[model samples]
Target chain A: MKNSIAALYLIVVAFNFSCGQDTANQVATISDTPFTPELLVEDVAIPWGIAFLPDGSMLITEKSGELILFKDGQKNTLSNVPEVYSRGQGGLLDVAVHPDYENNGWIYLSYASEEGEEKGGHTAFTRAKISDNSLTNSQLLYKGSPNTTKGQHFGSRIEFDDKGYVYLSIGERGARDDNPQDITRDGGKIYRFYDDGRIPEDNPFVGTEGAKTAIYSYGHRNPQGLIKNPKTGDIWDNEHGPKGGDEINIIKPGANYGWPVITYGVNYSGTPITDKTAMDGMEQPIHYWLPSIAPSGMAFITTDNYGADWNGSLLVGSLKFQYLELLKLNGTKVTDRIELIKGLGRVRDVVQGPDGLIYVGVEGKGVYKLVPKK
Target chain B: MKIFLTSYILAVIGLSLYFFQDPALEASMQRGNEIYADFCVTCHLEAGEGVVSTFPPLAKSDYLLQNRAASIRGVKFGQQAEIVVNGVTYNSAMPSPGLEDDEIADVMNYILNSWGNTSDKIVTVEEVEAIQK
Candidate 1:
């Protein structure tokens, strides 16, 4: 009996060793930096997205379905804003101006809308022109179908690439097993479309049978941060994982990012989602957070306003840690990470403004401009 | 024969205890734990210890234990007012989680019982349904 028990122990030990081999990748090294956050706008709740106009004015989206335009130090609540579902994690999500805003004057917004036939809400993308403190000529661009009442995973962020194509990220809508891996579904995808609502003919799944034609990439969990790297013109995103395994991935056409099938995270109940971190066809993230920072918004610093060390780095907001993380990049891999504006609040959104300064949005507070210390 | 008799008495006692125990609350808490992890854990954290001056702690929360109706109302509708939790003022808005009445009850019971908290009474679906916006 003793010998049999010893043999069983050896088998268990071997199994544990194999399982531990596929854990999360390298952890980011946090460094201290000197900076101060100056209050830009105050008394807002759950600022989800930030955008800048050509005239140095700011447009901020409050998650409870309000759009505020801050110009000349005054906060004006814009009218004709689309009504959002405004449940747990659903609400008015992201706002961005067209790359040719100076000539086209088009602004893009994403919100959780209940306009479809379904009872619940899903992410909807729309574009409008701001005129006299209200939206005019509003056009519904795209809306995800088969809405759900599940109060999680509404990955809605809007970005415009240099090529004038609009990209939107939608979460798996709490259907991890059903939606992420399926091409017919709407959620867990990065969708690309023309500035108008037309699907590009060259989209990866356009000719595929029964696939969502607008899908640029699939198998993403919940990507809240989507940005176009100004230097490479490549789209990048950062998504929240279950308990850990938050990731930063570069977007590619027709790529599978491996959500439930291969993840370093376990379920919140401390159960493993999967034992595989690397798969055959799944694209790996450039960097992933082990104990998830709950990343929300992302921006790349393109100017020398904060000196040489900050230029060409990436800025990501941490909702879980209440800090703004600055990641130094060498090509696509993150070499160093530094935490900024710690303990302010849940950093919901971060953006580089037209004035070449960084603006961060904090939940329950307001927006702050990050000023580097001399 | 003596061992058999002794085992028969032990079995009878075990069955009686099993039948008398509060199985409803036990099952509700198990479901509530899952709901908490999905909805509430992001802000309130795993152990109910919320972030300082941002999200308030639900562990041993004086506001939760003192105000029952307000707590239910906060979950039923969205909470936006200034309230004190553990002597700290938190005016942060908490959007309604859009959970069913039964789910709200289950999650409430789970929070009230775990993390050194004790409640003699269990939250029910009827109580959750009775709260107004």
Candidate 2:
């Protein structure tokens, strides 16, 4: 069309959808990222988690306590889901499939569960057998303790380690100081558990006085992103900071991550949560954000779908900024930062499909795919 | 002839509503929509269903429709005390939006009519200005 740069951006966008052949001019000017987003489906409600089945269908959880299977551009709600609290940052969130699912057929889910008639709830993880697109024989794996009416910070993302153990993160429920650092509490910790919902005896806090047996690592404010790097098999997480200091950390067993006591964040009222940023035995983050990006889901792209440059790059959804962020790493050290799919509105989750296309879910806009400019 | 004249008058009014609503109710609602997008979507949600028992749903809210002054006061001056919506008590403190009285009125108009809500009375700027803490 026109020779202007904005028009050139539209021309590449046109080719991304229509398969137009005017690529030679457009490809040279796409700034080496060569990618545009495509809408896949918007049928699911508040899609919080995404996991691909072996047959290329996707299992998605809506924050309102429903699960939908997106198959061939159609979505159908599955049956027999537990009743979720569905209150203030609490709901059905984060879904995962058993790594050895060819035999076990187990699908895992994490959601906020109502504790009683007292208007309190806690995050609960359950593993169920999905047969005929419905859950059956479900088992309660773990539930965060001391459910309260505070109604924020339900960090419940699930990642599976290579050794078939389950790693799940739970938030501090806004008790940044008390819950995060205490080993005996349920909130603000990542737990390692057997697939059958039993606590591992080797967990870091087991056999200790006044400690929860399921605690693996302690002192997280509210981690919303959890994943195992397919290349290194290390569990990494991204969490929201109070006012600033969102962080990304590589999780290690028995490690203290130093939340409220040692933080780079201040309270929402601009008061400091703590005066210290480092402590005696606590670990530090590999990457952190100031002024807070409110990150949600994250994934490491191991596919060559977008060519060599995009492979193994960490993609995280920014809720406050309404964009997807690319954190480039040169062997675990972040070297560059790029933003993509700008102004698409509050990215919620990002995952690389089996077909190597990046499937990202955004708030109110639903799920979309980011494809490299061909 | 009578019906035709009535239809013509209605058309003129509709046209005036579309093209020239500055400082009027329609203009207030338009500004309100933008203000809601900027400030309220994160906790209250896009559809205004609100978080269950926490943020208190704005869609078809009986509480908002019933307690008009309290709702205006809450938006104008931050609410920290417990309030009930649809019989569910909510205690979460809402910080003051720091918007002017006219901006509050505009956003109030936007919320009053959105997501299965319809209001017979308009929230005027003067009403918001009269609120104190």
Candidate 3:
């Protein structure tokens, strides 16, 4: 019996040694530098889009139509934000400072507002001046297609290109079938407008009637992530798909992207959407996630803070994965992927700050900075 | 020999206690409940019985109780088709919700327990990822 017990012990020990798994991949201690995601602003409800102001401060837009200014690790809540149509995917979305903001003092904001009767709400961009900590001279710059019941599918993301043109992403607003058929509809499209919110005469769809002249591209679902490549002057975006096909596409002027027609994702019940992942005249995504990462805010890595490996890479904040994804881009292709922060709550947006530090905003955990550790 | 054997048994028991029992379940469940209230309660309903004919009912769902893989996959990727539950068909669109696997497992556990459903198996994050395919 003693020899039998010894044999059993040896077997168990061997099994334990073989079965031991590493836990370092699961949880990580929050770092202070080289990237510490500490809470810089607290008690903000569902903060979504963030724009860095000229003076190194930031303007963050909450889903509930509150625009907050963060400076020196303190928050100053600005009031009189226009009453937003605060429903699903509605409310104040992206806030951006104009390229000539230093001289113009013009700040542009995107929000969903109630349209005429029978129409639910549409996304509208407004330009205003921030003086005395208040929004003044607020004027409507652009308004999206109106009349929809479902409160979801407002792809309101804003960015300014190197040419000083503001690019706005509009979702299909849950209207999947309509995306492929109509260019006149503002949903499922990217619109490019001048600083005054007027359509550029040289816009790709400028001569098309019924179609909004400001439209730059079409055939998108709800693109939530939009960023301009600082080096190559390229625009990129990622949007949610029906069941599992969330996509990241390189933005091109006047390109028709395939929506409900062509998708790698199937329906939620494992039903196939469309076998054709690419169609003629429809642009293809540079990269896509099969199981839907629910990617939200994305920023291009322009600096060398994360070493040379991460330079020219893209940091994508994954909401479903609850991680910050690093995408190494070679030309237009995303070459590699590294998940930096895991077990952290939903990361909302990532931004490169003036201090050469990377800042990331979490849904409930506040904002954090990624810097090299000492 | 007797003293050494006794010490070895005690060490094994101590390590088992430290490793086997989940220390995070209580806190995770609490946080899961809070998250459910804010994000899930609207569609899944306050009682976890999702809207009939629109959102499939999560209460005592065979999909929830039997097919753990499908349940996790359904949440990971939004369900946007006609899914039958308990002989009833539901056709609706649910957007891919933004939730981590740990939280997803915690909520699945809560659903499996509270809503007239019972299962001995605990949903783990590993199980959630394994069903991603």
**Strongest candidate by TM-score:** 1
List-wise, what DockQ does each model earn? 0.45, 0.04, 0.03
Arrange candidates by TM-score, highest first: which order? 1, 2, 3
**Per-residue lDDT of A1-374 in model 1, one digit per residue for the tens?**
99999999999978965654442333344454555689889988889999999999999999888999999999999999998987668999999999899999999999888888878888899999999999999999999988887778889899989887999999998899999899999999999999997999999999899999999999999999999999999999999988878999999999999998998788876788899999999999998886789999999999888888779999999988788888888899777777777778889999999888899999878999988778
Q: Ten-residue segment with the worst summed lDDT in candidate 3 chain A?
A: A20-29
Q: After superposition, how far is residue A249 of candidate 2 from its true place, in Å?
A: 0.3
TM-scores for all predictions: 0.87, 0.70, 0.70
Share of real interface contacts recovered by each model?
0.50, 0.00, 0.00
Candidate 3 lDDT tens digits, A1-374: 99999999999968954543223112223343255456667765566877777888988887767789887878887877777776556778888788888898988888887755655677888889887678999998888766664566788788889886889988887667875447877788888988788778899987788877888988888888888888878888888776557889988888988888898777654668788888888888887775567788888877777676668888878776668888776787766666777756667788777666777877655666675554
Best by lDDT: 1
lDDT by residue (tens digit), candidate 2, B46-110: 78888676578999999898988999998876676777888898765565555668888998999
Candidate with maximal DockQ: 1
Worst lDDT 10-window in candidate 2 chain A: A20-29
Per-candidate TM-score, chain A: 0.93, 0.89, 0.88
Candidate 2 Cα misplacement greater than 4 A, ranges: A1-32, A116-118, B1-133
How many clashes does each candidate structure show, in the order listed?
A: 0, 0, 7
lDDT of each model, Cα atoms only?
A: 0.89, 0.81, 0.75
lDDT at position A24, candidate 1: 32
